[model samples]
Structure formats: structure tokens, C-alpha cells
Target: MSRRPYKPVMSKTWYLKQPSYRNYMIREMSSVFIGLWTLNLLIGLGKLIQGPATWSQWLALQAHPLMILFSAVTLALALYHSLTWFRAVPQVMRIQIGTSFVPAKLITNAHIGAMVGFSAIVLLATLWGV
Candidate 1:
């Protein structure tokens, strides 16, 4: 009989065992969707560059229910990624103004406010075609 070397068994669901690990995994995985969305945007830009008809076709493709669902999911994941990263800024970096350190909640809230403001501006500009 041949003796086989002993190998440690690793469970596939090990990350799910801890909430922190699961959340970390989720935050990390969200980047994949973000990257996909970026690629999609780039492709759409390329289509626009090709011609107005090409861009219209691309827009029509995006109107499909499946693409709409994918976009929604990707948007949600991107939001999650942004929230987690912005919230972690205080913990990862110490910001001091004079003798007092800035609060993490304040920093996170400021970032969230900035994001909303910028998004609103972009939406309005896009709608106004400016």
C-alpha cells in the first residue's frame, strides 16, 4: 500500500463562518462589478465614437431587462464598495486639525454628502445637456 501525504482540508465556505470575513469578502468582491461597469462604460464610449447609429444600438441593448438588472446590481455593489471604503478612511488615516483629531463619522458623512452633491450635479447637467 502506498502512503499518501496528509493535506489539510480547507472548507470552501470558510469565509462565511465569520461575519467580518464575509463582509470583507463582499467589499472586495464588489470591485469586480465596478470594474465590469467601467468596462461597459468604456465600450459605450467606443460605440458613441463609432457613430450615432452605433451608439443608439448600444443604448437599445442596454434597455433590455437583463442589462437593466445587471446595471442595478452593479450600481448597488459600487455603492457598497464606496461606503465601506469611505467609512474606513478615518480608521486607516489619522487626520488632525490643530490639536484635535477629526472624527471618523464626520469624515464619512462629509464624503457621503460630497458624493450625493456631485451625483446630483452630474444628473442635472446630463438632463440639461450641458
Candidate 2:
């Protein structure tokens, strides 16, 4: 195999300049996002347990214009993170069936299907309130 000398790509923009830098940035940013999301869930549990008054405060917080906007942003970020993760999941937990590689599309579709089903369940549960 012939090898070529490595050449570095230089760019004025910090993140776009290096692939490694961009990947590291993504990793760090995702960790922070995941952490914040978990904390948000914990806050939700607190609001639930602290009685309807505290829960009403939480609901009011959710009703705030800023919170609504940030919730959308959070959903977008989570969707991106989940897509990246689901795409790589087949490779991580690869199944062997007579030494053939699994198609990535199948994994993606399965993930999408599961998400849709889960969403439906959550919606129904919320509506029924049982």
C-alpha cells in the first residue's frame, strides 16, 4: 500500500478548521445537553411531588414564552443527537446472520417506527389521564 504524507487543512473559522476539533466540540456539547435534559426531568419530578401549587408553578414556567421557545430548541437538539446515535447503533450491536452486514436503513426505519409508537403511547396516556 502506498502512503502519502499527511497534510493539515487550515481554516480561519475555529470549528470548521479541523475535523477532530469539530468532533470534540460535538461530543462535549452533547454531554452538556444530555446532562441538562436529565436535570430538567429531575426538576419535573420535583414539581410533581411538591403538590399542585408547585406543579402549577412548573406549568406556568412551561407556559412562559422563553420556555416554549427553548423546549423547541431542546427537541431539535435531541432529535439530532438521537439520529446520530441510532445510525451508529446497528454497528455497535451488530447481529451476524451468515456473515452478512445489516443495512443501515433498516436500523433507521426501526428506530423511527419505535419513536412513532412511543410518541403515540405518550399522547394517549396524556389524553386519557389514567
Candidate 3:
């Protein structure tokens, strides 16, 4: 019996062929931005603890053009990640009530609504603080 040769044939761009795969990759990439933003926040918090001058410096850095661009990108990525997660809920979580199945759209809408409500509260608190 002859041994067959193993084929090395995995394509790096396979995800580009399908829209869903592309969306998944984009959503996954959002985590990197999220991590960067979280680190930025932690550093800001540390600065705040140090003194008002240090905190002001941190805030000044955020006003830089590059920082602004980074913040915009991160915000976009965060929104995409959130929306993708909401879209995925129906597939991962199933709701049932005594032999009746809940609608997927309803679950997704509820998640989005809650997010908006929480965000509104945060915005209001921030305005109140200012």
C-alpha cells in the first residue's frame, strides 16, 4: 500500500469570501479596540488618583488628534461589537414559556433597549456632574 501525501491547503482569506464570515472577523477584531480603550481608562483613573494636574494632563492627551482618531475608531468598534452580540443572542439563547417559544427579534430589541437606557442614565449623570 502506498502512503498518500498530506495536503496543506488552508486559505488565509477564506473568511473574505462570505459576508457572515467577514462580519464575524470584524466583530472579533473589536475586542482589540475594547482592550486598548479599557487600558486608556485605567491609566486615566491612575492619573486621577495621583493629582489634579496629572489628571488634567491625561485629559489633555486625549484631546490630541491621534487620540481623537483612536477614540473614534474604538467607539465604532465598540458599537459594532455590541450590535453583533445582540444579533447573536437568538442563536445562543433560547427562551421558552411553557411550550411557547419567545421571538428572537424581541430578545435582541430588549438587549438594545436596555443598553440605550443605561447609556442615557450615564449621560445624564455625566451632565449632572458637569
lDDT of 3 by residue, 1-130 (tens): 4598788887999999999999999999999988999999999999999999999999999999999999999999999999999989989899999998899999999999999999999999999995
Candidate 3 clashing pairs? none
Question: Which sequence of candidate numbers ranks them by lDDT, best first?
Answer: 3, 1, 2
TM-score quality measure for candidate 1? 0.85
**Higher-scoring candidate on TM-score, 2 or 3:** 3
Which pairs in model 2 have colliding backbones? none
User: Per-residue lDDT for 11-51 in model 1, tens only?
Assistant: 99989999989989999998888888899999999999999
Per-prediction backbone clash count = 0, 0, 0
RMSD vs true structure, all candidates: 3.8, 5.8, 2.2
- How would you order the candidates by TM-score, starting with the best? 3, 1, 2
Each model's lDDT: 0.92, 0.78, 0.95
Q: Each prediction's TM-score against the native?
A: 0.85, 0.69, 0.89
Name the runs in model 1 displaced over 4 angstroms: 1-9
Better of 1 and 2 by lDDT: 1
Compose the digit string of candidate 2's lDDT tens values, residues 15-120. Answer: 8677967765675577677677678779988999989998888888888998787777777777767767777688787666788966878877799789879989
Clashing pairs for model 1 are: none
- 10 residues in a row with least lDDT, candidate 2: 23-32
Better of 1 and 3 by TM-score: 3
